[model samples]
Target: MHKRKISIYCYLVSAAFIIGLLSISMFISYSKDPTSSAKDDNQLEYVTPEEVGYSSEKLNEA
Candidate 1:
């Protein structure tokens, strides 16, 4: 029937619209700056306890 065909066409168009929106959103999310994820100004620094005035022997006892 013609009505059935129209219903199918509408369903296909709606599905395609949803897929397009999802792909656009995904692309926007992935294209953002990678460094923007860091929320803090103080990043972790690699340093030994001895440099901070802590003895290695005392750490090993714990």
Candidate 2:
């Protein structure tokens, strides 16, 4: 009876430990992916407004 109680306790403790570890792993796994600002750092080429479609005259009105 004593050995059985100890074994049960040990099993419960191990189960709790495993659950804690699994929760931590899931939390880490679901966290946002690492993003790099390097790709987002794209520099657009400067161009005259007329080159696209906006007229310089209309731009002056604003």
Candidate 3:
């Protein structure tokens, strides 16, 4: 029973250590480039129908 308790404690400590390491790495990476994980705020270029070979005049007639 004593050995089993020690084993459980070891497992818990190992899991905690792994989690801490992962958290630290994640924090460092995010701190370096916080915007890297965020969605792009840049506006997309607007294209006209004529630019893609679609006639605006034909669409207007329809």
Ranking by lDDT: 1, 3, 2
lDDT of 3 by residue, 1-62 (tens): 99999999999999999999999999897775755676557857779999989999999999
Count of clashing residue pairs in every prediction: 0, 0, 0
**lDDT (Cα) of model 2:** 0.89
* Tens-digit per-residue lDDT, 1-62, candidate 2: 99999999999999999999999999989985577445444667789999998999989999
Question: By TM-score, highest first, what's the ranking?
Answer: 2, 1, 3
**Whole-model Cα lDDT per candidate?**
0.91, 0.89, 0.89
What does candidate 1's lDDT look like per residue over 1-62, in tens digits? 99999999999999999999999999988885776766655778878999999998999999
RMSD of 1: 4.1
| lDDT (Cα) of model 1 | 0.91
Worst 10 residues of 3 by lDDT: 32-41
Residue 28, candidate 1: C-alpha displacement in angstroms: 0.3
